[model samples]
Target: MVNKPQKTKLSSVISLSHSESTRIFEKKSDLEVWSAFDKGDEMAFNYIYRGFTPIMFSFGIQITNNVDLVKDCIQNIFIDLRRKRGALSEVISIKSYLLKILQRELFRSIKKESIHSIQNIELPESAFLIEVSHETKVIQLESETEINTQLKMALNQLTARQRQAIVLLYEEGMSYREIAEVLEFNEVKSARKLVYRAIESLKQILKN
Candidate 1:
């Protein structure tokens, strides 16, 4: 008689399929992942939410120091994305697009909670904080403390918009067009000019 073949369990097969799908989604490019999400792929949505939630939280906290507000805004944007995924347009950079949404949401929440009659909600220079990393300190070595102090002081002298522009350009590695979209600038040149002026100001401050 021929030997009988062993059959795989349905549960094991399903688990393996899910694991493989997750791995594939993780490796996909942003555009591909986004397109998958737009098509109502649950795995693609999970990949996007897991990948970007931390980044969105960090960016939101910089806009305003309120932790709860940032958390709520992040949650709300993800929910909105899920609800409107089919209607969403294709974006060149997913990071920049999500960030722009979070920034606007945070600002709107802040304005609603403010008691003062404010025409425009301009964030105080103190509101956007940039902390130096421990790795950067180790790299600087001998003059770390003094240099960190001076660098922070230099940053403090910049306007809120300038500081934000510098961070988006250097830390986030976004293009001028992306930065313009995030900051609501009319043109890409405006974003370019903002970064240029910010760098020049930093150099001048460091020189002194």
Candidate 2:
């Protein structure tokens, strides 16, 4: 059986990294840091937690407006990581892996909360929200104002899954295979199709 770290120990492990360790791990690749972490290196764990927390929280908040719930879910995943580090699999992109875990954990927590609360909760299928910013590098248009208005409209027309696929592809810089893994698509082709459909829809909308 895999031994999980106790809460107190986990907290200490996550919180107590030295400056030298941070400097050392900062120069290491994700795989190296992750390998060290899996081997029970607290410094690597701290490095990961500190590095990824902002982006993870940003991704989580886009899925749902519940700030407290997003924070809680982020906290829980790190705890789970520390608890199950020994059983963790090899990871290529730590960002993609953590985002994938966060997405799953957010949905799972939302479902559980919905069951116990009297108020109806927004399901994962419809909950994803994104604001297409002025500096968006993926979609280029002839005019700035035209870009913002039309792009926002086009994005709004997309299903939650498609919008998410686009963000993961463009905004997060994930490969099709990574997207498939994160979105739970059975194959990379599914991820490709999703992004293709989404882009085609955007083009058609913008052209009109």
C-alpha root-mean-square deviation, candidate 2: 4.0
Candidate 2 clashing pairs, residues 3+ apart or interchain: none
Q: How much RMSD separates candidate 1 from the native structure?
A: 10.1
Tens digits of per-residue lDDT for model 2 on 1-208?
1134555676687677657578989888878889989988888888888888998998888888899998888888887787787888998778888988898888777878774663443335554555666677456445578667767877878888888888888888889998998887889999999999988987888788
Error of 2 at 93 (Å): 1.5
Off by over 4 Å in 2: 1-11, 17-22, 116-126, 140-142
Please provide TM-scores, in order, for all candidate models, with all chains considered together: 0.82, 0.84
Screening candidate 1 with a backbone cut-off below 3 angstroms (N, C-alpha, C), the clashing residue pairs are: none
Name the candidate that leads on TM-score. Answer: 2
The models' CA-based lDDT, in order, is 0.76, 0.80
Candidate 2: Cα lDDT at 81:
84
